[model samples]
Target: MKKTEPHSSRSQQLEGAGLGFLIGFAGLLAFQLLGELVVRLLAIPVPGPVAGLLFMSVFLLVRKRTKASEPEPLLNASSLLLAHLSLLFVPAGVGIMTHIDRIKDQWLSISVALIIASFVTLFVTAWSLKILIRFMNKPEPE
Candidate 1:
């Protein structure tokens, strides 16, 4: 009789994880590409990556409503991306360092603007949230 090797659960899990990562990465790239195309074609003010994220969000929302299951590939990919999210800031940090002299020259103005913007954003967000909650929680007419 020929002997057969037993299947290992750990190997299966590892394979699934690898595939999920690939799928997730591919999805992110695809969305970014779509975003770039849309921005270029429409001359939209928003950045390509930001547009891509909006597009992806709409796509996911539609998919969530239409499909019974969650998007495993996108979720897995996003999780992987989020895990090393801080790395994305490295380039921005480097760019800021390169512009250190310019920043130093306008530091006071920039700091004041940033602080004002932060307060404005916080107030607007809070006001909007309160309005939305009130609208949503209103009792329906009998």
Candidate 2:
């Protein structure tokens, strides 16, 4: 009689997802630490983790562009995390609950800021895309 291995397709997928999460968490920590070091060295106003995130974004973009023909393991891994990303906001929601009094005091300003920022971001994104499409379609100068 042949012995059957305990590993199965579902188990493999679960393992992959778990590994992906660990990789992403490690990447986040490494990037944040690097960003912190750079910020301290350069005396930048932005937070280290924010800078690190931007750096990671650029790295991911470049990697994707270069590996256009290849399968994107990192991208896929990150996408898996993103699929359930709303869960990540639960902590933030809880924190907000704790700050209800402060939120109430500044609700007006916070709402106004959020509305203005949303509109501004939408307008800028649309305008930039429009410009990019036009540039891409424009005829080369003689």
| Top-lDDT structure, candidate number | 1
lDDT of model 2, residue 36? 97
Model 1: residue 98 alpha-carbon error in angstroms: 1.4
Question: Which tens-of-lDDT digit does each residue in 1-142 have in candidate 1?
Answer: 8866567877989999899889888999999999999999999889899998998899999998999999898888898789999999998888886888999899999999999999999999988877887799975433
For this target, which candidate reaches the highest TM-score against the unseen true structure?
Answer: 1
lDDT of 1: 0.90
Alpha carbon lDDT at 128, candidate 1: 88
**On a 0 to 100 scale, what is the lDDT of residue 55 in model 2?**
84
Query: Relative to the true structure, how large is the alpha-carbon lDDT of every model?
Result: 0.90, 0.81
Candidate 1's C-alpha runs over 4 A off are: 1-8, 127-142
Each candidate: RMSD to true structure?
Answer: 4.8, 5.8
Clashing pairs in 1: none
lDDT of 2 by residue, 21-121 (tens): 77766776787899999999999999998999888888877777887653345556567768999999998888877889998999999999999999999
